[model samples]
Target: MLKKLINIVVFVPLGVLLIILSVANRQTVTLALNPFEPSDSLLSVSAPFFVFLFLAVILGLVLGAAATWFTQAKYRRRARSEASEAVKWHREAEKQRSQAEKLATQASLPAPQG
Candidate 1:
């Protein structure tokens, strides 16, 4: 219930704000890829203002996610190894318990009175 309210409060206004911004800045602009030339550029793109703005935002998100994944890789590896080790120990414990129970049953049997 709280999550839905928070989403509505935050996302609705954010969406409306973005729509207003895009509408206000609909003018086309030229983006020059070549750094050396300013007046005349061979590599360039002509797109709406919102296109570049959204592209930068998307790029930032992608780069940040990549960095986070790489940074936490060691932790993920350690957790996987720990999980496998725990499983091995658990199997060994069950085997020992079964062996003890079998020994107890054998000791309870009567010996030959020759």
Candidate 2:
């Protein structure tokens, strides 16, 4: 519920602002040059103004995902190493505690001090 409220609060004004901007600048034209040549002659997507916006959004999403995955890879590796080291330490501690208990029992069995 709170998340939905926050989303509405954040995106509602953003949507309104975009609508206002689109209305105000509805007559403007922007052009982008495609670096790669199309192989098919009939499938040339060269001229529409909205195509640039679409390509920009797609590129942004791909770059964002790549950046997120790249940044998190190191942290994931570190977390795995830390978890394994913690398990190893726990086992070593348990072994040492058991040995200490055995030594204590043996010492209390009335052995003569030399």
Alpha-carbon lDDT, every model: 0.93, 0.77
Report the lDDT of model 2 for residue 101: 100
Worst 10 residues of 1 by lDDT: 33-42
- What's the CA RMSD for each of the models? 2.2, 5.8
Candidate 2 lDDT at 108 equals 86
TM-scores for all predictions: 0.84, 0.52
lDDT of 1 by residue, 33-55 (tens): 77788556568888899989989
Which candidate ranks first by TM-score, i.e. highest?
Answer: 1
lDDT of 2 by residue, 1-114 (tens): 999999999999988976675555545353423446545545444544444565677899999999999999999999999999999999999999999999999988996889
Q: What's model 1's TM-score?
A: 0.84
